[model samples]
Target: MPITRRQFLAVAALTVSVREPRAYAADQEQAVFWRAAMPGRNANVLFGYARIDASLVPDIVSDGKRLIDETQRIIAAFPNVEMTAWDLPRRTLPPIWKSISRPVADELRAALAGLPDGVPIEELSGIEVSWLLMGEGQTPPNPYLGDVLARHSRSRGRPVAFLITEKEIREQFWLPRDPIVLNDTIDEPKIAFLLDVRRRVGPIGAHLEQLYRARRGEEIYRFTAEIANQGIPDPSTFIEEEKAGALAFDRLLGLLDSTDAPTAFVVLPIGILTGETGILPRLRARGCTVTPIV
Candidate 1:
């Protein structure tokens, strides 16, 4: 199936969160959103958000709005949003599906057999596939920071920009993975666990929702690392995607060098900000300070 508007934005979301940057300490309460600057005129703020469409997210959205109001410059994730890009793990669907082992495919198809909007395995794309495979309980019918904030900034005809282009992102996923390793990472056990997570909120989702709602960035990061360790496998295809920070950091520097004011960046799944090699820490090395806002 062709990717939908929502699916397209979701593709960009892959760059906005997950995929790479590896380090962190659990004890410190790291701020996901911040006013950060290197040794220059840039004091751009980065707001790392969770993808959950819930009521609590709006509070963070309001804070994000304040940052936008202050800077008047918002660097969004979507083609000039707004080429659309992939979400984590299940990225580049057709090929991933093509590689699926027979038994696992049968199980996944059978599991989706009873869902209300469930379609034949061949029909799924973007979030639908990922949600069915991994998400828990239900999604609240509310807008997330990505939905409400990204659209609002663009609609107002404000100074909107993107740190990473859609093509650069899509190309990142094009890098090949060893199918042998791939099958090992996403085996039947992994599928079953993900299916379990799909039905019940499970401990990670439950705690993650709390941390995300509470705006606990560092905790979220630590928890995310924990989740990754606890058997939630990240696909090998995303290894190349981890290098996104190098380009993103360079572009952000260009924005900082060329501009006279602060810029704002939005990241989904706030925890993606943690990893040792994460861009924020790199900024710190260059005399940039990232101060927590919420």
Candidate 2:
């Protein structure tokens, strides 16, 4: 029998529990690193967006392959160019604000008044509530500063937009873990394997190789059983899972600012690319030619 996408996510989540190795001298040197001078005139950054759905794992995998194909084509057209691909890792919501602050709880209650009455608002933090409302295309109060992003996503001949959210800042945001970059020159086979694993196991498998490299053991028995018995979470829960994606976008922007590579191609979840989070605007302000992938 084949493993399902949900199973893959459950397994991936389990890997997070493994005790991370303590810092070592060799580990410091082993950190993955790559940087280059910014691109000169005529260089454009490419942004790719795809909706994430466990039931539509095949479609998600196809979209990723398309993004990679387009990126390779771009690289081939430009000489003396160095490209970096960043995989936005998944994030978990911290304890709800009720556990820490009353003011945050009051704000959440007001912002999420539109949610279904049966929904458990108390279980969610203010941020998670905001993200859920946004996921549904509803604008939350004080949504990210700035106008909608990727306004020229289509005009630039980027990928087709499969999903669109009404307010961008309502998009989820979280802090990112350490950064890692995979190079095609030395890790071609590994790259192929990563893609194949994602095809079989879904997006969660996308991080499998990286987790293994960090010495996170592949202990899937418990996770398999847990996913087998699990049912789909409510909409609020689903949106909570997406909050980390926002942080991933922020992390990518930081990388763009630090590197000299004139152009960058980021493959991210659709919501993060299109939301009002000001990512597109911020990138453009930095003088980047932004083209979004469908």
Candidate 3:
């Protein structure tokens, strides 16, 4: 059975009294307090996300083990509450002609040419190639590639949390980014220009429009092709990335709402929590208690 919000707060207050000042201490007294405080009502939820600076925290990119550790320490404050982590999934390419790189296209064309007119499309080794061959005109036969690409692109680089308990607890959730405009054809020069603009003025809407307008028609195509050849110069430049953050928060809220837990504590990077694209306000509007741990 789910516990009411008021009951959860009462338990939270009791747990706080037993929490130790030093978060990293190894004393067994803290464990005893947690065991005593365990109520049959519902487990609390704690969520964390980060945007780390490699220069300051040098080891941040190496699978985020250190960040996970720190998050575990923070979760220790809540007794008997199970913790989980969420992260973005890998990115994959679509089977659309536009998404196909020049080299891959050439290979597919050559492979098709080698086969007889009536040869089965099933002979193709890759799913993308088979779909493209059977597809009509320039578009793919179905949106399979588009769907896969969408899922991958939206989920790439999202954050997850892990429980920091002595006993092994294996539970996790993935927070996928919301779908956004994916212009794969932006070239390097334009990417460089955009990166420069972002560095100089940040992600101002007017500034981006002004810079984009300055480029010629041919330049835009060239830029688009370059981006298609490569990936988005920087994922942060796209408005969708920001929207993904909000989507992640929404997922967290949904998870909390579905359970009987009284309180859900979310930890996110200071930058993500305070910016124009931040979702902290939305979370608060939904009655979540927000705390910033910097």
On a 0 to 1 TM-score scale, where does candidate 2 land against the true structure? 0.26
Descending-lDDT candidate ranking: 1, 2, 3
User: Which regions of candidate 2 deviate over 4 angstroms?
Assistant: 1-63, 70-250, 257-265
Residue 116 alpha-carbon offset, candidate 2, angstroms: 20
Clashing residue pairs in candidate 2 are: 37-260, 38-260, 38-262, 39-262, 47-293, 159-294, 160-294, 168-275, 168-276
Cα lDDT listed for each candidate: 0.53, 0.31, 0.30
lDDT of 1 by residue, 184-264 (tens): 454445555555554455533444566667767655555445335545433323435556656667766666555555455
lDDT of 2 by residue, 144-223 (tens): 11111222233344443212232332333212222221111212232233233334454432333332223222222222
TM for every model, in the order presented, reads 0.66, 0.26, 0.26
Off by over 4 Å in 1: 1-23, 77-133, 138-142, 176-184, 188-207, 230-232, 235-239, 257-269
- Name the 10 consecutive residues with the lowest summed lDDT in model 2: 24-33
* Better model by TM-score: candidate 1 vs candidate 2: 1
Give lDDT tens digits, candidate 3, residues 115-181: 4477443332232232222221221113322123223323443233322222322222122222213
